[model samples]
Target: MDNRKEILDELSGLSPRLRDLKAKGDGLTTPEGYFEGLSDQVWSRLKDSPKKETVVRPMRRLWRLPYKSGIAAALVLAAAALIWLNRPRESAAFDLGALTPQEAEQYILNNIEDFDLSMLVASRPEEIADPAGAGRTDTLDSELDQLLDEYLEDVDDATLEQILF
Candidate 1:
């Protein structure tokens, strides 16, 4: 009538039934290494096979970087050198005909009071009746030619007249 005794009785009966079913199947017949000959045949076929040959070609040519940028740099440097070599040299010799700074300043200061630049600025361009006279035509022509040349040479007319008159 106790509950523990009832459960133990049911489990003890189930163990015999499981043993009887295992005995009826193939689990009761075989032992180890039943197929040893089949394994030997497979390994012998793999080891006795032919080895493959790999063909490697000797490198006939190697790839390299292009030389165009280096060539362009060298050409530019050579052109610059040629231009510098062919340039004209400035004159190094001296001449005494030019006025010095002190001399020019002194001359301007000494003659400033006697000249009137405003009168020349207001004067009109009147043509000489005859820019030539007896026996003085060549002189007049030469002077006139010099004057015309100076006028056409782009010299500042106002500054020139101020200095002259």
Candidate 2:
């Protein structure tokens, strides 16, 4: 209780000093008309000073030509690589020399439907035509058909089953 009463007495004592300080108005002063002519003085000073000229040199585009071309080439190569990577490539032609006779025969039999017999006959005009110059002959057609039937007849049941299934 005594501590509180002492604090209150101290604060009351400082109140009159604070009022006196406020009445004295901080005791600082500026030169007469200092602010009124400040802008004009700054403008006059700027006007009286010598102006500085700025010189700008033009950039040489030729200097960067190689670098720009190199970047463009790299971008083109990157695009080409991306296109190559994404495109669907055709399977390479079969290397006939690499296949055994049986393998070649089997491959031919498997893809027999892909061949056009009519086109083959048409291409080999002399082969099927009569040597006597007869326009065309049913005998050659019958012979070719018989040869194909005989060839198929020679194949075993297992080979035929494999080819079919």
Candidate 3:
């Protein structure tokens, strides 16, 4: 009880200072006026703030800018394309005799003795003659010749040129 009474006395002694503080606080108690006063300052601060400006380059200028390393490649490709388009079209000519000088000619001109011509002849049949109903060996040889002729014809001109030339 006595401690409470002492606290009350101390509070009573602070009454005058409290009132002075309250009076000072009351001078700044305008709710609408405080915000209104700050409105112009806020807008002015915003208006004075720094702004970033962006610069855009022209498209044509960007296209016209020199490419660093690919200029040589582009020039080469363009030159090749121009030469290809403007070149005179000529039929392909071939003369195998003109390909190499005497050295290469000597390499291919030697006579070949490795080949055997006997295998090309027709084989002899078991019997000398077909007495009952046996077919002739000449018919089989003729058929083989026809087949070989047809096979040769099937070989394309380009393939033949590659082999011969």
Candidate 4:
């Protein structure tokens, strides 16, 4: 084809040596014994090179593992142990039952600002939920009123007004 001729002419113009090789119709060639001792030549170079040797400790790894893999496994085990050791335990749990009723009530009253009405109501028994059913509610209210009256009597007008306002 005309295209093939153009490519051939372009290649021949680029390299006259390529044109001569094309006429000869031969590619690369070597002498008859050029590769006869190729394996021996490679082995001679290998024999002159240095080799590395590594010593392994039997106690380093549980199984016969390589150095990097064994160290990774040991790190994972150490991390797991640390997490398990620091986790919360049932034996160290707070003993809610250990607190007596009076002690619990005193604690609640002392920290009353931390509690809301819903929380106090929910913690009370069903009978106490109805103030009419619990005589303690009336008694507590009267005691609180008496205490307030006694404190107000001791305070002068300005201090009482400041406290109220």
Instruction: Tell me the whole-model lDDT of each prediction, alpha carbons only.
Output: 0.49, 0.61, 0.49, 0.60
Q: Write the per-residue lDDT of candidate 4 for residues 1-165, one digit (tens) a residue.
A: 898677679878798677666666666699889788898998898898866566556665445545678778889999999999899853211321254656544554444345444444434454367767577655544544554466557768997576546
lDDT pick, better of 1 and 2: 2
Compose the digit string of candidate 2's lDDT tens values, residues 1-165. Answer: 897566556656878576545546788999999999999999999999968776444355433767678778888999999999999842212332355656545544555555444643454466456566433435435544555576588879987677667
Candidate 2, residue 45: how far the Cα is off, in Å:
45
Candidate 3 TM-score versus the reference: 0.23
The weakest ten consecutive residues by lDDT in model 4 span: 90-99
TM-score each candidate: 0.18, 0.25, 0.23, 0.24
Error of 4 at 119 (Å): 12
Off by over 4 Å in 4: 1-127, 130-133
Q: Residue by residue across 1-165, what tens digits does model 1's lDDT show?
A: 576456556646878565555435665554577577768987788789866676444332112235556667788999999999999752211211143645433433444344333322122112233444333545434543554464446557785677567
C-alpha displacement of 77 in model 4, angstroms?
Answer: 44
Q: Global CA lDDT of candidate 3, please? A: 0.49
* Rank order (by lDDT, best first): 2, 4, 3, 1
Runs in model 2 deviating more than 4 A are 1-116, 126-137
Scanning candidate 3 in windows of ten residues, the lowest lDDT window is 111-120
* Clashing residue pair totals per candidate (backbone < 3 A): 0, 0, 0, 0
lDDT of 2: 0.61
